[model samples]
Target: MNARSLTLRNVNKSYDGVHMAADDVSLDIKAGEFVSFLGPSGSGKTTTLMMIAGFQHPTSGEIRLGERAIDNLPPHKRNIGMVFQNYALFPHMTIADNVAFPLRMRGVSKPEKERRSREALAKVGLQGFEKRIPSELSGGQQQRVALARALVFEPDIILLDEPLGALDKALREHMQVELKRIHKDLGVTMVYVTHDQTEAMTMSDRIAVFNQGRIEQIGTPDEIYFAPKTRFVASFIGDSNIIEASALGDGRFETAVGVVEARATGAERNSRADLLLRPEMIRIADAAQPDRRPFKIDTTINYGDNLLVIGKLGTQAIRMRVPGVDARRLTGSSECHVTWRSEDIHVIA
Candidate 1:
């Protein structure tokens, strides 16, 4: 596939002409890259994707495919494949015919259509399930048919808007791996929109985090997960313990618990800041250790492999995750000590 870069410049969409559904968004997606638009509902991720697909026009700004502007183009004219949440397969047609529909629309001959349709199905790991109707296939199989249809035309890019949302949890996870393998093999530029952070983290090369009609941050999964720019991004991406504190300089902060040692990112001395600590980063330690806080164990949840310890440090509630073996050590004890490395704490100014 000859993948081409997609660019959105200052895209804006306003429903009432007063409130923007997409607010001054500008993003550049590299060719052959897999990027996910991740956020909650009404966060403008789906809206931005619609604009790119020409289903919705941007209120203002340019939507470009490589060097050509496509903001004014119709969805069909844009040569971009789209897979909706519902899969949108034809109930009356067989699976092969459904996959061949795009080629048929493009006026391809019958022989060529049949060859390409089966090839697309094989690409999605559905080689022999061609004669069956949509209703006969499982939800996961139907989704693969939709994806095959999208890729049958060999468009420069494919847009998937929560295409796996209908599947069960186990199937959804299995499809995530399948989709990643397909993308890697085809090298097609893919823009996926979903509210599932775990999906985005596992599948995307870089994540564009959307909130309130704008992109809050765009970075690799590690960067977004570990060093979030805003408190919202920090809290939204994963399990985070947000601690309100005041900067004490020299990589320290004064909180309700005590003066904690943490690497201050952008907090000025004597100013208010928020510290983000991931549950897995904190560990059980001796009470006499430096940077340690006395934790009153309130509750514990065991997940077989790992356990979550919810407790309090002074008046604030904190959570820590430890391995199952470590959880054994905390058994029969209501109190313990928790400490984290300075680098593990992310300071949000």
Candidate 2:
């Protein structure tokens, strides 16, 4: 596949010319990079993707694929492959034909189309199923066919909009692995639009977090999860304890958790800040630790692999996740001592 970089410079989209579906959206996707546009519903992730794929026109600003401006190009003219959530395969056509549809549109010869279709199908692990119709294949297999169809033409970049959404949890997880593997093998530039945070975190090399038609942040999974710059990003990524605090200068804060300390980011004295404390960072206090907060247990939910303990540490409600081994010891207990390293606390910028 011929992978190419994608750039958007101040792209904006509005349906009624009054309300912006995508506001000043700009992104630079590197050649062969797998980037995900991730957000909650109505946050403009899909809107931005549609503009990139030429499905929706930007009211203002520009889009560039590699060195050329593609804002004026039609969807089919863009040479970008797209996979939809519904697995848009022809029901009556055999899997081989479905995979070859794009080639047929491009006027590829029969022998060449058959060979490329077979290779594409093999890349998605659907080699022998080419003779079967869509109805005869399982949801996962049908999705594979759709993926093969998209890859058969070897487009510059591929856009997938919630492609695994129709499958069950297990199948979806399995497909995530498969997609990552295929991406590694093909080295094609891919832009995946998904509302699923975990899906984006696990699959994408970089994630563009969207909210209210704007990009909140774009970074790697560790950077997004551990070092969120805004309250929205901190709260949306995963389990967190966002503590309101008053900066006390020199990286100290008066918080509900009491005198929380953090690395200085040149915070203004007396300014307000939000402290992001991940659930997994907190731990049951050691016996010798002098400073231990009294916790009142609210509930304990066991997931076999890990135990989620909801409780109150003084006035602030807190969630703590402990290893499953601790379940037997901590399950029925009303309260337990808790502590967290001050360095683990992140001050949301």
Candidate 3:
């Protein structure tokens, strides 16, 4: 089935004269693409998703589904499928009955409803278990039933609001893969809302990082992780070491670690600056290398797959991630050299 694009123009919401939700948010979701609204609690991600689902109205804005205004449309008339955090299945009904409910509500013929229900169940790997009650299935299976129910209706768009949040870690990861495959196979426009960064990165075509009721940046996983546009984005996306510095003119800066060359795109000379360095970008070398700069190892923590190497450089404590294989050679209190490429330094003002 073909999917239609969704657009939100100047969306804003408030309660009791206080902005408790979205703020002038404008976003366009292309047809057949997967987008995620990712943020911490109270960041307005859920508020935005609810507004799109027609469960909550925007204080002021226009929501268009392929040029038709849907802001005033009721939830059922909007033709959008939704899967909630709770499975929300009918405990007394069988899986097939639950999946067929939407089609039945639409007045589909009995034969057609049965066929669609079976097909939807099969799509979610629940074909032979159609007669099982919700309580008879595991949590993951119950969630799959909910997904099958949502897809059986063949709505224009599917909105998943933390649908996998209730599952265990392993099950959650498995569901992420399954959900991605479903989206690819169906080619349906999907809007996923979650606070998990890893889930958003693994499944979305583009992620809109929300903060304080506004989108800080919207981009692919790589772009959002490596080229964050704001300090909040940098801190929120991943683990980063932000070093305070003073610009020394001509793309140079004096940092606590030492004087280092940096890319100064918008900062004025002599102004304060912040440089971001990924742990993997920093490397430790043998002190015997004559050209290597001096550094002191303070501590080492083994993390199975890798080691977190903490050291001191000119009174500045820095951390580096070393592969587990190589970490066996280094010991605490050993002197080492610390070096990083100039390109690896991300300078921010």
**Candidate 1 lDDT tens digits, 1-349:** 7688999999999989999999999999999999999999999999999999998988899999999899999988999999998999999999999999989999999999999999999999999999999999999999999999999999989999999999999999999999999999999999999999999999999999999999999999999999899999999998989999988888889997788778745567899988999999989997568767789999998899999999899988998899988888998889898888888888875
- Please write out the lDDT profile of model 3 over residues 256-344, one tens digit for every residue: 88788865466777898788888888776666654356767778888999988877777877778888887776764477776787778
Sliding window of 10 residues with minimal summed lDDT for model 2? 323-332
Ranking by TM-score: 2, 1, 3
Task: Score candidate 3 by TM-score against the native.
Answer: 0.94
Off by over 4 Å in 1: 264-266
Using TM-score as the yardstick, the better of models 1 and 3 is 1
lDDT digits (tens) for residues 1-349 of candidate 2: 8899999999899999888889999888999999999899999999999999998999999999999899999998999999999998988899999999999999999999999999999999988887989999999998888888999999999999999988999999999999999999999999999988889998999999999999999999999999999999999999999999999999999988788888776779899999999999988887789877888999988888989999887799899999887667685799899888878899987
Global CA lDDT of candidate 3, please?
0.88
Candidate 2: C-alpha lDDT: 0.92
- Top candidate on TM-score is 2
Q: Residue 79 of candidate 2: its Cα lDDT?
A: 92
**Model 2: how far residue 268 lies from native, Å:** 1.5
